[model samples]
Target: MTRKTVRIAMNGVTGRMGYRQHLVRSILALREQGGLDLGDGTVLWPEPVLVGRREHALRELADRHGLDQANVSTDVDAVLADDSIDIFFDAAMTSTREDLLKKAIAAGKHIYTEKPSATSLDGALELARLANAAGIKHGVVQDKIFLPGLLKLKRLIDGGFFGRILSVRGEFGYWVFEGDWQEAQRPSWNYRAEDGGGIVVDMFPHWEYVLHELFGRVKSVTALAATHIPQRWDEQSKPYDATADDAAYGIFELESGAIAQINSSWAVRVNRDELVEFQVDGTEGSAVAGLRNCRAQHRSATPKPVWNPDIPVTESFREQWQEVPDNGEFDNGFKVQWELFLRHVALDEPYHWDLLAGARGVQLAELGLKSSAEGRRYDVPELTL
Candidate 1:
């Protein structure tokens, strides 16, 4: 019956993902719900102190959310130096995240951040080592694992739905409009390699964790990365060279002998039910999972079709799959993880997804890019602290 308030220093609220997912949907949403119940007769309340580079944007966000203006500051150092702040959360640009996280660890604050934890594998490992040495609770954002569709898929896996998983195929991405005619949906930096922008670096980290958590740890990767759009207009309506790869096609070998092929592109148009989808095939059954829905076809119900080039085919192939039911309410993936991290910090609860896991993700990305450049498959070496 007691309330415990934990102050969180929220950095990079000016960015799209930080503003929408981390701030509004996660932290503010929890605040509106009267905090999280800790199951120990204690309500873990979160108080957010906005930290960013722009004073105007911070003030505007605070005003929009009806938050106290006094809690918003452009000085991240001053915020991190505050002893009252229990956690420092970052959703900033990948280029600037490492230094900020290191400073937070030095300040003795629990740190949580978005991945690719650093621009390189070495930097990611350094963050992990520093956080462990500092004895502070640290975490990296692995939000997709907590998604509802993935949850249902995991349930099926646990229930022996997919006996002896065979392979996984994932398709993710959408066409980002060139900024000349229509303003690009994504920031200009996403297409510039100099600014820590590239489809391979941006998404390979996600694929690493997703494949590892669901199927198996990736053992090797053969990839081909391309910049489909060579030129694009920036936010200022000026043309610039798009040096980064906008699309990547990769084949991954998993430790469990399962093969995973994934295609990530920002130039392809959507042809699936969701923006992203994964089709997992096994010896006993197969399932396709999107961001919110999962459908499965068991061996018993699967239809057999004959290959014919001359005859008209009508098998109702899509109808063969049965929809997975949502037996429980599913919250936003970001919000769920926030609550878990809050519990871990407040009650010393166990959390296995730390900065080391993030380093593994970054390692996959680096290897993937290398594989693409060399036109050869590369083995994934095991990383240790």
Candidate 2:
């Protein structure tokens, strides 16, 4: 038996997302059971060559993880040039993604980068082409597909529980902290359009999975987007202009003749969760999954509509649903995808979450942007895998 180990390099591991995605998230996942739980070689762990601009941050990470001189550095090129490093993982901000990913592919390392893979449609397509041409494994972080709630829904759909699925309605939104007085926070880059930001691009990948998983591919989409909030304060108490779309309403048409409507927002009042809430209807049955519960209604007892708002209603339609239990522990969404990447590289396994899927997502955002700009419907391009 041959000894198995795949050396890996991380690019942009210093920024907020980089720190979480690369250092805390990916590093925790690479271990057997996370943090110092290095078992007796049960799972294949990749040695990391951390590359970032911040020396102090890198040094701190190295010290915290005991990486020291073994596999840590400030030079990205050095890490890419090393023959031992088999995988290149990128959790860099969206603006810096394309060039770095292309560089890694040129260096002949398998790649896993965060979405939207690139800010533009052509950029993502080109990256996919490069990865395909080079014959290196490439995957984008599509954490939503692996979500436990959605996974259960996938099983139900595959089991033919929802026959000839018709439409999907998704409501996903909540107010995110703008690093105001509380200074508690979300990534500021997300609210800034120039830095490759916005709710449409940031969250469409999640909708892509649910829509593609249940109905099929998207043929076209029409959207309306807005910049509801204009100013927000950063950590320094300096006000920054918000340029990205804060809220988006989109209608999707799947290739399989099904339709979908999605509402993604940053200014919505939280009545339910900000999570991806779904209501899927079909010929045989219907399923509804959200933060609090997952419910189903068969064709036998489909709604006929009772029209008395003042009347005493016994069976509340909303109260009929029951909570979906936690299928997996509360791991960061980043960590779930990170582990899959490790398995993909070390085990030589097939990872379904690829760059093409990410490109489709980019296309969706692009269409949303177009619809918002042109003030009309935009036909989504099919996934060019």
Candidate 3:
């Protein structure tokens, strides 16, 4: 089989998500597995060029991964200028992504990036326009849809298990420790408004795609945002005003006429089996899916509970639901998307999750924040390049 190396200039490998998920689990894992077979008589090998501001951190990461230090560079411009680099992948801070992507597009490289592609809808739209104008293949990270639980949920949808879907309820969050006693689980910038950080800006993209891809396009949204913790310590044990919203409660109206209510918060403690969970109820069946597992209850199997104020309930409601079995081995969601994008770049395959789709996600986040600010429902408009 003929082998081809796809050089990926990956920026922001120092951040937690960038380092762990994208770099380690996805790109490096692909390298470890001896590359992806492209179905034709060819195998696509991924060669990662780590790019970021901190040269030492990049070098250290490269060393840890047994990668050549010569592939690590602090100069993104030089990396972009390299004609050999086929794709430019960004997992950098959201505020800085648009400009970097613009450069990569200008340098004639394919694009793949993490979402909130920009801080605003217009900026995101601009990137989409430029990439389309340049005729460069592009994609955004929509990792949640490839998750095991969500995949199971999608399977049920395809099998008509939900029969006339009715509504979806999602709960996502965990208490991020303030940097005072224990170092914060997340970066301090996540709580700062100026740094393009907030739960709405960060998570609404995930929700937008999940709702749009699985159910139907979100037609309208009514949301309320809050700064549950007004004060928090930074990385250096210095306290700062936590300006960004830590929690967001949203009610979304889907085009399919199903209502989705989601509660996203960083101040809440975990009570469920997973960090994030969605309970979808329909006419024929209902399913509750977490990050890894999914459980469903058919309308015929659903237990009826009598409302009794004075008497104790006897039915075991949780026990009635059947667990969704994994018929296939689930790989890391990030890695799966990387392989798909690589295939798209190498084989001219159809990939719908382009920069336009990412722009829609940014649009949702922008409108969600606006809805919260105005204390009113906002209609989601269709976006075009």
- Alpha-carbon TM-score of each model against the true structure: 0.99, 0.88, 0.99
Comparing 1 with 2 on TM-score, the higher-scoring candidate is 1
The runs of at least 3 residues in candidate 1 whose Cα sits more than 4 Å from the true structure, single-residue gaps closed, are none
Candidate 1 achieves a global lDDT of: 0.94
Using lDDT, rank the candidates from best to worst: 3, 1, 2
Clashing pairs in 2: 220-380
After superposition, candidate 3 runs with Cα above 4 Å error? none
Which regions of candidate 2 deviate over 4 angstroms? 1-3, 15-26, 34-43, 291-293, 301-305, 322-336
Task: Give the TM-score (vs. native) of candidate 2.
Answer: 0.88
Q: Write the per-residue lDDT of candidate 3 for residues 219-274, one digit (tens) a residue.
A: 99999999999999998899999999999999999999999999999999999989
Candidate 2's error at 17, in angstroms?
A: 4.4
Cand. 2 Cα-lDDT: 0.77
lDDT comparison, 1 vs 2, better candidate: 1
Put down candidate 1 lDDT per residue, 108-177, tens digits, no spaces.
Answer: 9999999889999999999999999999999999999999999999999989999999999999999999
